[model samples]
Target: MEQDVSLGLAIFVEHGREREAADFYGSAFGARQFQAHHIDGALAGVEMRLGATVIAVAGANPRREAEPSRGGPFFPKVAGGVSTIIQLTVPDIDGCFAQAIAAGATLRDEVQTDVAGRRVASLFDPFGHIWVLIERDASAGRRAA
Candidate 1:
């Protein structure tokens, strides 16, 4: 069954307040709750749909805490971090930036130009997850955020 399924991307977050985190994410990106499970008065898992992507969150598992780190080395916090970044492509950089800021995300960087002709900005959400917002030139097509 594992071989039959192709891997898509999803994020896993450990929240001291799982429901609060879920609500925040739901409000931030207009995410819709797809699935949820509760066990022992704690959230076991939740799946939310943000645009076309799926994100999963759950209470931290004590047994899985020993896994090796992943994510880019430049962001040390991202390595083995509970908060995982999810990028969004938007038509208006300034508008999206304002919305995110208003939704309780802290501005991490001012908008900057990349070599690939994209306007990009980074932000840290209320839950400490990192998100990169990208405005791509219609002419350039999609590359990387």
Candidate 2:
């Protein structure tokens, strides 16, 4: 069944960490890869779906001074850290958060209700992407405000 994806996210990791990122997402979030593009037996790009969201993982484009108009000279958040956060709306925030931690994600914020009353938790993936796991089910037990 083909999904009519309206919008998509493309994330670029450090030049050779594409496979690792894809694999991590798969194990931690149960993402299923729909396609993987390779170059000379090396993984170049991958497309996967986590529920309704389509996420594309790829290696950062090489930094070239001449190609100033290129889509990226993208760099992974190794030092300064990234401002983008990949938020996953899941049915089991606690379980998923544990899985991500076991899969090498460093816990950033423990699971708690945010100011907006959403049950949320955040972490930094090994590849340096920040992920926020959110459980929006009203029955999931939000703290009394």
TM-score against truth, every candidate: 0.68, 0.82
Model 1 Cα lDDT, one tens digit per residue, 1-145: 8767643444444535567667877766667888888888778667887776777766555445444453221222342244456688877888888877877778888888877878999887765677888995766555543
Checking candidate 2 for backbone clashes, the offending pairs are: none
Clashes of each: 0, 0
Q: Cα lDDT of model 1 overall? A: 0.68
Candidate 1 regions exceeding 4 Å error are: 1-10, 62-85, 139-145
Clashing pairs in 1: none
lDDT of 2: 0.84
Instruction: Give the Cα lDDT of each candidate.
Output: 0.68, 0.84
By TM-score, how accurate is candidate 2?
A: 0.82
Q: Once superposed on the true structure, which residue ranges of model 2 sit more than 4 Å away at CA? A: 1-5, 64-73, 140-145
Residue 116, candidate 2: C-alpha displacement in angstroms: 2.0
Worst 10 residues of 1 by lDDT: 71-80
Best by TM-score: 2
